[model samples]
Target: MHRPRFLSGAIAVAAASLLTSACTTGSGSSADGGGAGGAQGGATVRLALTSDVTTFDPIRQQAASDYVVGRLMYETLVGQDDGGAIVPRLAGTWEQTPIGVTFTLKKGVTCSDGKPLTASQVAASLTRYRTISAGAAMTFGPGNTGAGTTITGDDKAGTVSIELAAPWGELLPGLANSTTGVVCSPGLTAGDRLGTGAVAGAGTGPYELVGAERGSAYELKLRKGYDAWPQYAAMPAGRPAGTLRVSVVRNESTLANQLQTGAVDFGAFTGPDAARFGKGGFRVEAAPLIRNFVAFNQREGHPGADPKIRRAVAQAIDANAFNKVFGGTGQVMTSYVDAKAPCVSTDPSLLTKTDPAAAKETLEGVKIKLVGSNAVGQGAGNTYVQEALRAAGADVQLTNADNGTWATQVMGNQGDWDLTVFPMIYGQLARGGVHFIGDEPADGRNFGAVDNKAFLAGYGAATTTVDQKAKCAAWQKAQKALLQAGDVVPLATVNVHYVFREGVSATIPAGAFDPVTLRIAE
Candidate 1:
């Protein structure tokens, strides 16, 4: 899924520099959409999309659209504000203890079935997610595959216990992941039927999924009397008047035409597509998306396994060359940690300025293959990387997979490709500090093979350290170690672009829009 930030599952190829415009909203209203519910009775917000949501099942879905749509149907136990602060969601209050963390469910919350949302359901759902979903490994602590982290529901106590392997950081952020949203046992117990069969889209969100035609359109109706959102006050608030119709239109030009003709009110655009928008009808806003990368393979026998070759690849390519691909619209990435994150750093070790001579010397006839999502940016990147490697004296080929297959193909290490332009589909990274570096490769999350004992040790210290400076220093050490290892290279963190009708107002975080807050102009 690099994400709907690029789909967000291993999900996308986006993130660049910013280009802001006039806009305002409690939930991110933009340039006077007649101030939220402007229509007399209500308004149906039409959203045009570039791709169908990869999956609707919170547990199995990893794409950015999945996360965005997931929020519309489900609610996270914790959610981040625009500034990325962790706030409560399904769980009203949470307290940490030496042994584990305890979360208290909010009272009176009900699923779409009108059944009371219970602590038992929440606990069982997490357990079920571990068993059925690939996201169990994405939860930031020792996952289901690892020892130590465990979940227990005490309905009598009216609380859910999230006991960690041992006080791991990112516990809050892990729970906050949209994939970790609470669901009733029926939804979870219903199995594959819940995701694809009749029971698909069942959840406890402010809106209920009414119908969906795969790769065509999705319809969501407001859950009337479901106005009590978990974090309404911190961000924008809105109750759309009518059903929300999400249209899947992969063609950029056709989608632009639709927006112009008023067929849809919103559309998230690619950089080039956005560049074509005139000043009047659409609102173009650019914000930090994600750190993009050309990740290398580090497992024992790959070309990237050779640190010199990895260094060569890193030094050979020019990230700035990609700016032209975005229509000279974004920043070239050079770090793993998002610059917008509170933990931003300027460590020199993470930087990758190209040196053709060094790259050529390192590669000098080495053979490799670069695989990427069939995105324009990835295609350009494949070209640029292939050219650079060829110039640096290596043999490389470019292959593009359907975007749906991209998220998994890069991670599967299926013995076909050697490198990828899109980095990992990441979320809530800073909280846990360095789990991504140490996650087991088999979990599918660990695409780059990193086995630095020093970094792993620093990751352990990061979990327990109370002081901010010590934690940052520990994280810095880990980052440097990974960079020096040559396999894990950092590139530009750029802004992702999305376009809205002149009157639509919405808030975006890391290239993801908060579906609950979307408001339409009359």
Candidate 2:
């Protein structure tokens, strides 16, 4: 996701320079109609979302929509405020030691099922995630292969202990993620049944899921008898305002039209639609999104296996051109970390810039195939890359892979393609390679299968380092190996834009991706 800036002459010119192709008005008040709620009992706030949510079960779902919906259904041990600081949620307070960290559960909290929330329940949830099948385990850590940490629960004392092999200063922040939301044992057993049809989790949140229809819509009702709502001392408006009715609309055009007609109070917009919204009187906001890049499948023994070929591909493509084509919404990143992250590299020279002559010389006799998803932006980006590589004197072919089969095809080496475009779904972690790239099976997201001892050593040092600067330096060294080796090419960091009505007021914090705060007015 890229930050949204006020449109300037330079930005407008940059956007106009990019290959580009490709709004509405409305007012009414029904849960089904697109207007502000009426001043009556049982009103619902409708939100039209862009992505479809795959699953309500947090442990098994990886989609951003799932995380957003999960926020409505479950409560994490900790949550980030509008300022991006870790604040109390399910857990009131926490303390850490060399061995592990302990969190004290808040008193008198109850799940949707009316069960008393306790540390035992939170520990049980974590244990279940660690022990469950592959899909579930992958949510908590690197992969679903094995559990590297242990969690203990003391119900009576209302405390949970998370033990790690090494010091994990980011443990609290990590736990604050939706994947670690506490769940009652019954809720776990019931699985996504409630998530599919009704509010399931025993959360202390303001709203509860009443009905969900997979890819269609999710209906959330006010949680009656809930007392742990955030205090709004200044405004004194009704908590949560009212029930939230979220609908998944895949078509950006239709979503824009709906928002304009007052069919939906809020909606998400991207690409060309962002500009359209700005011109149409809608408020557009941007958030930090996972960086998208074209990764050379090192596992595939082909031209990509050659460092020169990979470097050639990286040097040939113009990130600025690609971003321009895609509508200059994101930054061309050098490292995996988002610009707002503390671990981001400061040296601008580290980033790859367009160099056609250098690229041509490097790829003199190379022939490569580039694989990418059939998804919209991905396909466009891949085509631009293919053109760049062709211009650099390499024979490249573009091939399509469905999202579900993409990872499998790359891992199985079934295709003859030398490079594949893959989004670093894990964001900053993708660059750190702490859990994805190294000596161990867990060490490499380097799907290209390239392993350098020096890179692995640097990664190990970075993960164990306590000082922020030192850790950044160590990670920088590790990145240098990946960049220098050209195992994967860093492209532009994609920016996601959310469009809301004029009356709505919100801001996306620096590090967070989702735009949940948009629902809250100042």
Best by TM-score: 2
State TM-scores per candidate.
0.80, 0.80
Which tens-of-lDDT digit does each residue in 192-226 have in candidate 1? 66666225335877667788888877777666455
The CA lDDT of each predicted structure is 0.60, 0.57
Cα-based RMSD of candidate 1: 6.4
Quality of model 2 by C-alpha lDDT = 0.57
Q: Estimate the overall C-alpha local distance difference test score of candidate 1.
A: 0.60
The CA lDDT at 487 in model 1 is 48
Clashes of 2: 21
Candidate 2 per-residue lDDT, tens place, 326-349, comes to 677888777665566556554656
